[model samples]
Each structure stands twice: as structure tokens, then as C-alpha cells.
Target: MERTGTEPVTARSALGLRLVLAAVYTPLFVLGAVVFSLWAASAGPGSVPSGDGLAVVAGVCAALAVLAAVDLVVVVRRRRRERGGRG
Candidate 1:
């Protein structure tokens, strides 16, 4: 479907906002993964089963990072297509 008048602008702006949020979250998620990985690695094998917990945290962070990256890519592609259409 084609966007009419201001609708395209609004949709583009929304995508830009989402891209910004994704950019902000990507680093945070990466940092969380790094921290969790370190904590998991440092934990003693015999120590309380915290490794599993840390692993879960790291996994979640990794997933978030992947999702954010995907979102960024999609938004950028959409913006490119929009711009290309206008030219």
C-alpha cells in the first residue's frame, strides 16, 4: 500500500525513533552480555550454580543485541527505499 501525504513522513519518523532506541539499547545489551559472561567464567565450578543464571542473562543480552541490530537494519533499509522512491 502507498502512504498518502503526511503518513509517509510520520511512518519514517516513527522508524527513526525506533532506530534511535535500538542504537541506545544495543550497547547496553552488549555490555550486559560481557559482564554476565565474565561473571559466569569467574564462578567456581563447585560454587552455587550461578553459572547457569549468568549464562541465561548473557543469552538474553545477546538476543536483545541481535534483535536491535536487526531492527536497525530493517529501519535503515526502509528509509533508503522511501528516499529512493521520492527521488
Candidate 2:
């Protein structure tokens, strides 16, 4: 169960936790945004959320997308750096 000191940590393993979390949470966030929009649309004008509410949803989705992109870039660069160092 324990990791031996002889084993080297690669970027994939190092980023695995964050990547998993991001993968799970990001989709849920986007789905929630979509559902919210659909519900708002179906509810008609009186029940619809304000423009600011829609803007907030857009902003959150955008931020999550940016974060995911940055995480991917960091993982890729780390993997490349690790490979370069090993060779």
C-alpha cells in the first residue's frame, strides 16, 4: 500500500487528483448552468432570472473552463519536462 522510495512520481500521477476533481466538478458546473438556463426559459418572463444572474452563470462557466485549460497545460508541460529530464 505504501509507495517505495525507488518509485519516481510522474506528472500524470502528480496531477491525477486535481485532474479528477476538475473533470468531475467542471461537467457538473456546466450541466447546472445548462439546466438553469433551460428552466429559466421554460418558466416564462416572470420566473426568469435577471440578466445579471445569467451573466454570473456565464462567468462561472468561463472561469471553470479557464481553470481546466490551465490545469491541462500545467500537467502537459510537467510531463514534457519530466520526460526531457529523464532522457
Residue clash pairs of candidate 1: none
The count of backbone overlaps in candidate 1 is: 0
Model 1 residue 69 CA deviation (Å) reads 0.4
Show model 1 residue runs off by greater than 4 Å: 1-13, 45-49, 85-87
Candidate 1 structure quality by residue, lDDT tens digits, 7-61: 5455536887998998899899999999998989998887675888888999999
Alpha-carbon lDDT, every model: 0.84, 0.64
Task: State which candidate has the highest TM-score.
Answer: 1
Off by over 4 Å in 2: 1-14, 48-55, 84-87
Top-lDDT structure, candidate number: 1
